[model samples]
Target: MRQNRHITSNVGDGASGAVAAPPARPADQERTNSPGLALGAKAAGLPIAGLAALLSARIVTDELGLAGYALFALITTLPALLPLGDLGAGAALLDAVAADDGSPRARAHTRGTLISGARMLNLAGAAVAATGLVLAGTGTHTWLLGTAATPSAGACVAVAGVLIGCTLPLGLGASALAAIDRYHVALLLQAAGSAAGFGLVVVAAGLDAHAAVYCAGPLAGQCAAGAAALALAARALGMPMLRTVAASVRPGQQGTRIMHLAGPMTVIYTTSALTYGTDRLVLGHTTSAAAVAVYSAGAQLYRPAAALLSSAALPLWGRYVQRRGAGGGTPRGELARLVAWFAGAALVVGGGLVACGPPVADWMLHGEAPVGPGLMAAFGLLILVHAVNHPVGMWLSDAPGLRFQARGAVAMTAVSLALSVPLAIALGPAGPVLASALAFAVCVAVPCHRRAFRHG
Candidate 1:
């Protein structure tokens, strides 16, 4: 009788005649999170891409000589500021998209934000390109690097400016793609386009074209590849007509939120640019182009470590946001575990870099350099500090410490100039690292780590 009853229950209910189970969740279909894996893999590729680009630059620089190299960096850097003219839109759009994942609202916002950001960047880039032409026409050629006095040099600057201006819209799209977790596609596009750009530079060099052509090649390729991505994203999101979307969306307050978030970041990035980007420029004033090249080479050797470390933290940060939403406070145990994980990885990776620094430098530079074991050790120590500082500092904005985190960022900025100047003088190229280490140690790590364990 019991078996008969069970069989009847197992049979379809009278209403539908189908035995029903809960719907399969999108997450349940995959044991591991696909997006997370994609992000991690993309993060891993950063080191490889950075290394390849550096090598490509080195090859072109070697072929054209130091004048070619300096001109390339200068031309590239000049246009870089043009792309940044989008203000905080890129960061804002990413935040909005990530916040609204998995809904029609998310789809709408993503499409609208992307279109707005791209258009803004494109216009800005074009304006800058126009300015470059005017400068060239007016004989204000001093800003054109090696072409300062020569007509051909001015022409080269104008061309490079145009290429850079064209790239802004595409670069904006690349950033957007990365934010949407299309990491693999983004990486592929970046690698192929960047490589092609290098080839373009080499070809231009062979023709005895000004080094500006080498600078222009990558920018042109980036813009071209980026257009494809923008199209793909636009289609995927089912974006409405630009006018209709803007009229319907309430992006004003949301835009403000994004600026609030990105403003501090902008400051931090600006300071970092000053700290690091100014290295060659400052050296240029005090030293020879060869010296700048040597410093740049050493700097490049450490670039992989720096980039990978930051990349690895980013997706983990997204997870942090999700977890914070679910809980009242940051789980102390979880925070500790993550911190330890970062520290351990940093130790292993930093030790390896320190061990291999000299050999790697020799290979990259194609000869002996003054970059020695001490410099490597200094680099490793910086990485170690970053490993500890990054997570702890990030966690300050989570859970019970949100206010503290804001205060901490402000404090860090307040003290940055005071902290950085002495360290920069004391350590030369590695001064920023020391300053960063000290900032976290004093402002974030010392306090947060203690508070996290106090409740236990």
Candidate 2:
């Protein structure tokens, strides 16, 4: 996030149009281009798929009675296995392909690496799912969350397994697609799959299929989506279903380099996941289901705003990288600008949420749901705190001191784990939210942000 130019000339030399802004550099402002438009539209499309997810959550809560919490918890936790899935290798593949943009060999190499990566991730995910089942069977499911049902408790482990398995490949594909800038196509496939999956759940609910059959439709739909993504990737790059890593390739060197970069990145991703996911799952277990529902609804509404800030920050990240550690004379001025923009936008969004929260909650939870007002306010506070800290985290990502980011994540996770029980005991659901906000601001926001401008 760096910018400095002859604004006077670009603004028309104090003439009638003097205030007009100059266009940005290609690398820095690629978001202004057609490709950027496609990507933004694709990202925007997430809300639609998210809508389907909300619907699915609602139906599951309303009809099947939250049978999939154990499944969701299990699947989400499995992403912690990110280190083994060639998460770093995928990043390397994308960078290599982009560097060799004109080479056919690069495309083939990337495709092969991606396929290998996907397989690795799928295997790891399967192992996690299996572990979950074993835990459930052995009465050790509480490690997953206190909510996991025992095997004989009649929870649908099989259906959950299938759903978790199907989404794994698609998750890999989505990451691969994002790395390569094929965002629009990925978004469409994700949306279609989510919609189809949710529709199936609705139908199953209507027909009153097997007690746990609700998870079946979503699993099947995700599998189809994964297949479609594979086909699209193959067709776009003229590659095939690669079963193995290429014999001629030197994975030890290439994959290692990829992993080195992705190692911290994977941790970064996983820590962020844990920071929030732990709170949700833990809250679900320790508190009422209705409280979980209310918290989730508030989060769901707040997310789009956070996402938009991230979107705005994306181009600036590239710009910051191009500046090569300088913040364009002001030494991190660009980063600060991006952060300010995000903060301003977040405040507006958060305020709007606070204002309309009751009505919004009522609609989301179905009718005048009679949920807690304090819960809604606490949830909004969580999002706003997240907004402030998130950009600091992003700015930290491009710094040479990025390792600090990983440490921050670990700290945040530690705090989340440490405080989850006590806060739940003391203040119930709101306690976790309070703990999360405090941890992020302390462990992440304050220190890294200071570092961003320290030497500039």
Candidate 3:
């Protein structure tokens, strides 16, 4: 889902979904300068903020021990896997907003329509998640962590579902901010929300709160963050939030078209979720909760580094969309520069992690979660592969290239699933990382890069 913010788009020339070249304009200068600063802010803010959250999580995990930390991880993972929750409407709304060229009144109406539809879809997602949690609680489905389905855990899952449902609409707000080129604000709000959530967890741990109580911290913080973002977006747009919601109930032609773009995106996102998220599910089902803790702990080290790199690349989406709309050709030199930067960053970070990650992991996990050097090295390599591939993937996100990218993603997901099972069983926690790294190289990185370069 974090990747979704930085990738995917529907904005292009109406014909062929490729932007026709446009005459140089003043707005282009603004576009050029603004995105650079925004990207820098995101690159700096996300990792710093993510580190804070990660540290807090480390504290909570240490306090709670392996089983308790696993429960927390399980609660967090549930809402992430519910692909239908937003019904692809947020992505659609982003496209619609980015491409909108209408009178203020007209644009507001379209925004309202899109917002309403997205809200409904998110509500549906929340409902489905809640129902699933209820079923899991009642033993109608397998427990996520293989724990005895206790009444308390069931109650906690229900609460988490409700929180997830509430957060769904907030994603639209963040997307709206991005569409309007308020990327910094969107990123800041996200960072602030994460920090708040981390603080809550840290405080809860300090008080020796139960795992369920600790779980509530993240959900509550997310809700707060979402509300703040929605308020800010509404204020910026000069539209009442309630009126926007009302307007969305009656979608116009544009709203319908947005959904058209969203359909395939939904599938893309679903497969992506399966590809990236299956590791935890596999670990939960096939191994113990403690195994999940160990794997997730090691994996957590990779996330901030990835987030930092991804943030730098994310601004390219807006820039590319603008260029595509102007009918510009691929910026092969710029792409090369980005790829080089990512590759260099990967070498530095991956090398450092390979050298230092074991001690850090041991310290964070407090010996309760054992992360070997081999696991650290594998995780570092995984990060390297993803970093190198991400910019190329983002470059290929325009409509003309989207279908091919989707196919590649599907293939990657299949390979990831196929390999995850054997590797997980054979290698324990590091198995999924190795499997995903291989899948990306074979199914996504190679094909996408080759196609991207050829097209360029």
Best by TM-score: 3
In the range 53-153, model 2's lDDT, one tens digit per residue, is 66765665566444343343233233332333344444444444333323345444454455455555566567756754675566565555444443423
How many residue pairs in model 2 have overlapping backbones?
1
RMSD of each: 9.4, 9.9, 6.5
TM-score-sorted candidate list, best first? 3, 2, 1
**lDDT score for residue 370 of model 2:** 46
Question: Number of clashes in every candidate structure?
Answer: 0, 1, 7
Residue 293, model 2: Cα distance from true site in angstroms = 3.4
Give residue 71's lDDT in candidate 2 (0 to 100): 44
Candidate 3 lDDT by residue in tens digits, 2-119: 1111112222221112212222234445545655656676666766565765686577667866566667766765655665546666656666555554434435444545655555
Kindly list the per-residue Cα lDDT of model 1 for residues 328-433, writing each as its tens digit. Answer: 4656776677678778877886787778776666565566345566666666776776676556555443334544544554565445446655555566545544
lDDT winner among the candidates? Answer: 3
The lDDT of each candidate is 0.54, 0.55, 0.66
lDDT (Cα, 0-100) at 451 in candidate 3 = 82
Model 3, position 271: C-alpha lDDT score: 77
Q: List the pairs of residues colliding in candidate 2.
A: 1-320
